[model samples]
Target: MAQNPERRAALVDAAIDVLAREGARGLTFRAVDTQAGVPTGTASNYFANREDLLDQAGRRVYTRLAPDPASVAHALETPPSRELVRHFMHDIVRRVTADRTGYLALLELRLEATRRPDLRRTLTARLQPEYEESIRFHLAAGLPGDRSTVSVLYFAMLGLIVEHLTVPEVIAADPIEALIDAIVDRVVPRE
Candidate 1:
């Protein structure tokens, strides 16, 4: 069945907004329907259950986590790839810092799913795509590691952000920036 592109995009945007605002706890069929300004039945028609919606939303958010290939290309279209790097860095910081609430919810989702191996399997199914995207992005910038490096970095970033949010004393000052810089230094060679 074909989908309406505009509506699909709106649903995705709504999913991000809902996730960012309320976390996984707040993601329900009716809630997303309201967020998208569509009818509850409409959401149901698109998603069979809460898990389906959340999982799909998770995928959407994961895909859009950073400066995508198109944006990277456009940013580098001019004289300086510096603009592209800056744009990418700016995007990364913004996305990571802005969606703490959602990230926490995702963490909770994982935790809850731990009791049900089937659910855990369903939720963790997202890890591969997320891992692949990071690996591809790092590789695009000439990083020398495989998917494992990207997975490790991705998990570490989330862990650091949570720690920084929950226990500032345990976290070093300028942690996010430091991590970003370290990642950049590895992925993008310094002049």
Candidate 2:
């Protein structure tokens, strides 16, 4: 409802932190305002309701977690190959790990979505296109994968990220990079 972009962005970002730290049940407008260090009701001013805040937080997490353009360009500069796929996978792990809060907030949003149909639809709409694009990019870039390969790799990496972030002890046996290499090797054929 507020027209100030900076304040709105700050509120959304604060909402993300609140979600990650307190889960959906604790994500109140007051919590976000306190997290943002703004006056009380500031978040409510920016967001029409809890649902609006949740939706914006979901979108903000993705925006925060998206790869930098420079990295994308660097990846594209290298010839498409299994090694490149490995590089991409490694980057994914690194980025998510580096932004643990964002990923955790995203996980929280995912759980909340189960109870909110509108959120489920919003997340599905946002994520499905990216999933499809991964497949398209793998094919168009001539990466060593088909749709199934990309799908499996996507799922495997997602599982690994969840484990690494939520219950790291489960994967403490091996270095994450080593595990990433194994996943890429198994899914993407050698050139």
**Best candidate per TM-score, number?**
2
List ranges where model 1 is wrong by over 4 Å.
1-3, 70-91, 98-109, 115-119, 132-152, 164-175, 182-191
Candidate 1 TM-score, C-alpha based: 0.60
Residue 92 Cα positional deviation in candidate 2, in Å, after optimal superposition? 0.6
Q: Pick the candidate with the highest lDDT.
A: 2
Global lDDT of each candidate = 0.63, 0.93
Residue 125 Cα positional deviation in candidate 1, in Å, after optimal superposition: 2.9
**Model 1, 1-191: lDDT tens per residue?**
56677776677667667766675567677777798999776777776677776666666665555446686677656543433443555576577567655455556556657665765787777776666776787667654445665566566556666675556577576666676666545554333
- Estimate, for each residue in 1-191, the C-alpha lDDT of model 2 and write its tens digit: 32899989989999999999999999999999999999998888788899999999999999999889898887899888999999989989989998899999999999999999999999999999989998998899888868999999999999999999999999899999999999998988777
lDDT for 110 in candidate 2 is 95
Alpha-carbon shift of residue 138 in model 1 (angstroms): 4.3
